[model samples]
Every structure is written in structure tokens, then in C-alpha cells.
Target chain A: MTQLPVRTDRKLGLVIDLDTCVGCHACVISCKGWNTENYGAPLSDQDAYGADPSGTFLNRVHSFEIRPDEGAAQLVHFPKSCLHCEDAPCVTVCPTGASYKRREDGIVLVNEDHCIGCGLCAWACPYGARELDRAAGVMKKCTLCIDRIYNENLLEQDRVPACVRTCPAGARHFGDLGDPDSAVSQLVAERGGIDLMPEQGTRPVNKYLPPRPRDRIGADSPALTAVAETASGFLAWLDRTLDRLPGGGLARMDAPAKEENS
Target chain B: MNPAPSVIIFTTLSGAGFGLLVWLGLGLPGVTGLTAFGFFAIAYLLAVGGLLASTFHLGRPERAIRAFTQWRTSWLSREGWTSVIALILMAGYGAGLVFLGTRWTALGLAGAAMSVAVVFTTSMIYAQLRTVPRWNMALTPVMFLTLSLTGGALLAGQMAAAKALLLLSGIVQIAYWKLGDRALAGSGTTLATATGLGAPRAVRAFEPPHTGTNYLLEEFVHVVGRRHALKLRAIALTLAVVLPLVLLMLGAGHLVAALAALCHLAGVAVSRWLFFAQAEHVVGFYYGKR
Candidate 1:
């Protein structure tokens, strides 16, 4: 059914901490390596070695510079995937009933066999999480590493998503988010983890732990003893001291300003 | 958002086809037996041809039948179902008009209602989506319905009706574009919202997720220049509205009506292209295209 389950005992999801993510892309590479073969259809690359190679990837890591009004800019690496929202639009919008949200684990998935690859699911998604596998003629998306996560044969420690297991920075945490006492749920509450685009109203199961702002670093360091003691601004005292140099120290390096003024 | 030619043709073609069917259901002036056949042939050809064109863009076109199964919650499914109902009703009505020399009022009315409903469902496919804020509006369905009526009136050679609808639909199209522009400009979803980084005054992409243009970028990150759009809109308005209105005023002339229909079709095609090209999906924010 395209309609979401009324309720689920567990909402297994990921909590990504931006503060700890180094943007190394280990998780992305790991997810690609795992899902390409593990999922129902192999994720294919078109012109993989050619001049313009492109392929399907379930996960993507985007880097951005966020400029704040009152502080230095911060670079953040945002890893994105199908959030498996409680109200998964992609699932409900599918005409073929191919896209579905699981009642048991709360993972949203596409039945490749039934998928017509009409691309409606891709359009419905706000996250840009799902991609059409051109070769397989099906939509591909992060399955939350369903095969590995639920495989009885796998070791207990390996029973997690490839991205979570392979994250070097340990920035990714995965567990049942529905249980208030669960580690992931507790972490979300403690860190004030926020849902991306809460206004979108998808009610995503996944949460993102915001990076701690180092707003005062370097810019507001305690003044040096000499610099603090200066009557005028510290730069004025430094200017006078530097004027004693061989070629009027600061002037030589900043001669272009004088030339422009003249 | 790619303005895939197949879909544009599909929507415009089928819309006109269904529009013609609406007029046929209400009854046309040429009530002769073979004339009905001829008119229906054109309507079916365009409607079915457009429906087929839609399938051309699908990756697995063979599995399109599966689409009919999910009408419960999917607008696309409702579209397919309504289209089928409209097509069957119209087809039966055409057959009756051909052999029996009679119009079944109930069947014709139901078919006409379904025809309009099909177009409504089609518009809802995009209008209901929150992903593209510009497309998600009540005006979308109104625009589709208005365009369908205008096209139908033109095809049926109802020059007076066509002229009035042309003017109304033209105004609706302009209003829709104006509202769409404002909606996109003022949309709350930003790069900050996409990445869950709310602190920033402005967030810009330092690096894309990949060097290669992925499916998301290819499918959603369409950019249309404002100057070109304005020019196209002007052309669309002249051809689709102004010229059609002028030509249709040459009342009771089939040649002028046919010419007006052709011009209006060309104009609607342009507007459809702009519709897709201008849509800025929320996913575009991820690629810094929004």
C-alpha cells in the first residue's frame, strides 16, 4: 500500500552530527560500494571511465560555506539520503505502488520489479535522495542498507548501515528513534537535533545534530599584555613601533594604497 | 523540470483532445453521422497520441499498466483512471452518434465531466507537490481547466466561445506566471533549509557532491533566463491569445478558426515549456540552483 503504516514499533533512522563530520566521504564511498551490489538492482554508472561519467548513488555529501552575520564563516558537509519520513511523499505519490514505507522498520523502499521508473517518486522527493538507475530502468535510493542491517548471517557488530559502520569520524549514529529511551532518541533530545526543513511537513525520522558554533575563536581571543595596555587601539601602537623599521615596514608592503590615493 | 518534450506535447495535446471531447459531449453544430466520426477521430488521435507521448519519457514504458492499480492515494493513478473513463465514455458516445444518429445525454454529460476531471487530476500531479513551490498552487488546476476549455472551443469552431475563453485563459496564464514568480522568489526553503544549517545568513556550495552531473541535477536543476522567458511569454501571448482573438473575430469563417486553433496550439506549447523550465523544485536548493 502506498499509504504509510498507521504505526510502527521502531523508527530506525540516522542522526548525523555535523560537528564531527570531517567531510572525508568515507561514508559515501562505503555506501556506494555496499549498495551497488547488495540492493535488488545493481547501481550502474554510465560512461564510468569516459569523459563524462555519471552513476546512481544512494547517498551524497555536499559541502557548503555558511556565512553568519556576526561570526566567521563555517564549512559544513551535509550528507543526504532518503530520510524515510513518517509521511514519505515519495511512497504515496507512486502510481505503481512500487515505492513503499515499511510498517515494521519504518524504512522507505522501492520495489524495483514493480517500478516503472516513471520518475514521479524522484519528483516528489524534496531531498533529491532518489535517482533513476538508467541502466536498470528503475529508481534507486538508500535502503538504509536493509539487507545488511537485517541479515542474520552478518556479525552483530556489522548489523548497521554501511555509511554508519564505515564513518571514520563516528559522526553517524543509527538506532530506533521511536523509543524515547533509545540512544539515538536521547542524543537527539540532548543535542537539540533538528529536522531539515521542518516546514516541509514530511516529519522525517532522521535528525541532524548541528555543529557547535566557534563564533569567538581567534576573533575574540584575550588581548596580549602589551596590546591590552595600549591607550589607542592596539593597531595604533603597533603602527608607531613598526614605523621604526628600515623602510617604514608597513608602508613598503602597503605602498599601493598610497599610490592609489595620490 | 527538464521540460521534456514528450510530456509537454502530451499534456497540451491530450488537454486539447479532452477539450474537444467536452464540446462534442455538449453537442456540436455539425450533427451529421460521418462528421461526428471525423471530429471524434481527431479528438481520439490527439488524446491517445498525447497519452502515448507521455509514456515515451518513462524508463519502463512497458509497465505503464501497473499505474492503474494505485488510484487510492496517487494522483497519477487517478489521472489514468479518469482518462480511461473519459476515453471510454467518449468512445461509446462517438459510436452511438455514428450508427444510431443519436446522442446519449447522460453518457455524454458524464464523459464531459470525466474529461475535465482528468485534466484536473493531471494538474494536481504537479500542483499537489510541495517539492516545487512554484507549481504547488490552486491556480495550476484553474489554468489547466481554462486552457482546456479554450482549446476545446477553438477546435469545435465555436469562435465566439473560443475568443472569450482565449482572453480569460490568457489572463489566467499571466496571473499564474506572476504568482509563480513571486512564490519562487519568496519560498522559505533555502540552502540552509536543505542542509539543516540554519545559522547562516546565506549558505553557498563550496563543492558539489560529485564532479559528474547526477540525475538530481539533470532532472531538477533547470535554469531559464528571465529575459528569454519574458520574450517567450510575449510570443506565447501574441500567438495564443492576441492573434487567436483577432482571427476568431472573423466570425463564422472556418479558415480563420482553423488558423486560430493552430496559432493557439503553438502558443500553448510555448507556455507549457515555460511552465517546466521555470519550476524551481526544492531539490534544486541542494545543488544551489534554486
Candidate 2:
């Protein structure tokens, strides 16, 4: 039996465009649908659609309204997931060798059969990409849809991952990052893509295009400030009136107060 | 870190077992040579037995042979190889002592060196894991080396009925313990640096991605209360280092000295547990849980 080499040079990865993302969360839902049906085990949800619906998900979008300075604001929706680094610490720390990086495609995969559910690989991951499947007693992560992408029957254009395929806003892209001529590479080059937490030295293959600047929302724009101030005043008045109401009004009262104070 | 019985037993039993061998090998020549030979033989078996007991902690024991493959980059592999070397050295040393008498001094010295190497390699296992801030310090190797020496010396003193040797070893042990404490304090400071945050900074969980507990929180972001940790450290230092040193200095009886060694062993075990529990991996920053 021939043993497979640990690393290959193909360098398969993802590139996300923050500029175009509307934070619709379609990628998140699609990822859950595909991984649950195809992966070793489905991501389980406890009390889902009930009081506290929660489950494992490979992709999640975080919406942050950044206030960089006075009168300057931006809503940046960051979709966080596995970066699949070149020097992946998660692979090195696994005592069982269950977590490994493929040299062929640069894909970091976990062999569920060999995993002991020790949770060591998850700890080693700086991005919090890997999650333990409690029911299976093994680790799981975004495979980048390895099973779907390589299927012989799929059309070339439709060969991308479920997240990329289902992304309604065209925020996600997948391709051979090692290929300098690839569309993803060209997009990254032209857009000046940045890696999150480059200080960690994980050498993440995933690149994020920074949020686009909105011309009308500039700090010096007097019209924008006037509109914001009016909106703030209306919200504050509504909040004060709501505070004087019954229990139903108490939850949202602080939101208007925070806006007025800011 | 959780006072997991398997790990505590592993560290304690292995430390005591190896420490006993070091003492027997070094002090046997000066004492009644025949009984010393018997002591060394018993010590070697106990050390091997302790190591064997540690294997039970592995989930896949059948695949343990594969552990040897990564010796190039793994301290764990080095430990395994060195442990085997130590066993072989001990066998040769025992043969020479039993059959060749005092002429085995050269081989015995080799065995002693091997014993020390085994302890050092074991120490490096914990020291090499950079993720655990508490264990990833120079003090780790120093602590293990000194603990072995202290345990071995005290054991030897009890066996040989040597009060002066016992007192000297006891003082050294206490000094090392203090140094270990200071090193741990410095490690804590370094941890603050690595985390890129100042001490006393209140970090609230702004927006955790998952509502359920994930592997990061379960494994790395362990939340042992600060008060409990401090109390444990104090008790461990007292019983494991201070009390033992004091008893030895006062020329305590052989039984009392032996008891002191056991107490210290328990204390060291507690300290090792806290070492893991209190360690905060930098990845906790992503979850905003640090």
C-alpha cells in the first residue's frame, strides 16, 4: 500500500469580498444544509426554533457597525470561518494524527475515524474554526465542500462549494489560490485584499476584501449628520414614551437611549 | 488541569518512581552495597511500571508504536526513546552490580546519566507545548529536574540513614521550589503580554458566535476561580516544599522523611494540575471570552 504525501502544492482556498456582502446569511444556511447532509455527521441543534436555538455551523456572519471617528460610520459584515493556513498549528498539535493538511490541495481535513474527541485541535485553532460534534465524539470543520467540488458529474461552473453557489450577494469565491491567473487571485490583487489577524502568523490562505467606502456617508457631509441627528431625536422620543409603557417596551428602550447619547 | 485522576497519578507515580531510581543509583555505592543492589533493582521496576500505567491514558493504546515515528520534531518521541535507553542502561547497570561488584561504577554512572536524561525529556514534553503559557517556560524543566533530585536525595538519605545529606538536599529542594514560584509569576506576566492586553482589564463577551459551548471554551478557556487557585498554590507549596524541607533540616526520622517525600509529591501533583487549568490559550480572543 502506497502512503499519501502529507502536503501537495495545489493550494485550494477561499476568497471573500466584504465590499459586496449584504450579510443576507444565505451562505450560512446553505453550508448547514450541505454539510449536514454530506459530512460524517450532521451539525446537531438543541432547542432549535424554540427558546434557545443553537447548533454547529461552519460559517457565521458577524455584522459590526464601526464608528471609526466622530460622524464616520460603516456597517462591516464579516463572515468568519476556517482560514486553512499554510502553517496550520491545528495539524501539528493533534496527537492522533486525525487532523491533517493535504499537500495535494492545501485542504485541512479531519479523519473522523481516527479522532478521539480530545478537542486539542480545536484549542490550537486561533480562528475557532473547528468544532467538536458532541454526538459523534469527533471533530468537524468546514471541509470547503471537498465532496461536492470534486464530484465528476457536476458542471465546471457549478463545481464551487455550496456557500459560494448559494451566496445571493456574490460575496464568496472559491478557486485554486496557487494559480496566479485565477479569477479569485485577480480579484484579490485588484481589490487589495487583507487577511484577518495577520499578526498571528498562521499565513491564512483566505483573503478578505475590505468594506467599500460610501461617498455620501463621509464625515464632513453636513447632510448626513442632519439626517442622523433627526433620526436620533425621533428614536429618543419613542424610547422615553416606551419606557413609560408596560413590560413589552422595556427591552428596546436602551437602544434609543444609546443612540441619543452617542 | 481538572485534577483528572489519570494524569495526576501518571505524573506523581512516574516522578516518584524515577526519583527513587536516581537516589538508589547514586547513594547505593556509599551504603551497604548488597542491599543497595536490591533497592536499585526494585526502583527500576517501579519506574517502568509507572510509565506503563501512564499508557492507559491514551485513547488508542494499540497504535502507541506510531508515537516513535515523529521523533524528529516531537519531544514526546524523544522522551519515549530516552525512556527505553534508560531501561536498557539500568539493566546493564544492575547486571554489573550483581555480577561484577564495585567494578560496575562506570556503567552505574552511565545509568545515572540516563535516569537524569529521562526526567529532562519528560520535563521537555510539557515545556514544548507553546499553547499552554504556564508550561511553556524554562522553569518547567528546572522544576522537574529539581523535584527529581530532591525526591531522590530525600529517599537516599532515608535509606542510608544519613542526616547531613538529607538536610543539604532538603535546603536545595526548598530553594528550587521558591525559584519555581518566581518563574511561574514571570510566566503569568508573559501570558499577559502574549494576550496583548493589560492586567485588570475587564473583558466582556461582546458577541459570542455560538450560543452553545464549543471546543475552545471546553478545552482552553477553562474558568478556575482565582481564589481557589491561590489557595491551592499556597497549600501545595507548604506541604510539597516547605514542610518537607523543615522536617529534613530537623533530622527527622526515616519514616518522617519518607512521609515528607509523599506530601511533596502530592503538592507537586496539585501544582501541575493548576498549571493546565489556569493556562489561557490566545485563541480565546476570537470568542471574545478572554
Best TM-score goes to which candidate? 1
- Locate the minimum summed-lDDT window of 10 residues in model 1 chain A: A223-232
- Determine the iRMS, in angstroms, of model 2: 6.2
Model 1 gets an lDDT of: 0.88
Q: What is the DockQ of each candidate?
A: 0.59, 0.14
Local accuracy of candidate 1 as per-residue lDDT tens digits, A1-262 = 7988998778999999988999999998999999988888998999999999999999889888878886788898989888989988999999999999998989999999999989999999899889999999899999999998999999999999999999999999999999999999999999999888777889999999998877475757875443454446787878777778777765756457757966
Query: What is each predicted model's overall lDDT from 0 to 1?
Result: 0.88, 0.66
Q: lDDT of candidate 2 vs native?
A: 0.66
Clashing pairs in 2: A7-A103, A8-A103, A8-A104
Q: List candidate 2 stretches off by more than 4 Å.
A: A1-8, A17-33, A36-79, A94-99, A112-120, A131-139, A212-262, B1-3, B25-62, B91-111, B158-205
Model 1 per-residue lDDT at B278: 83
The A-chain TM-scores of all the candidates are 0.83, 0.79
i-RMSD of all predictions: 1.1, 6.2
List the lowest-lDDT window of 10 residues for candidate 1 chain B.
B193-202
C-alpha lDDT of residue A111 in model 1: 92
- TM-score to native of every candidate shown: 0.91, 0.73
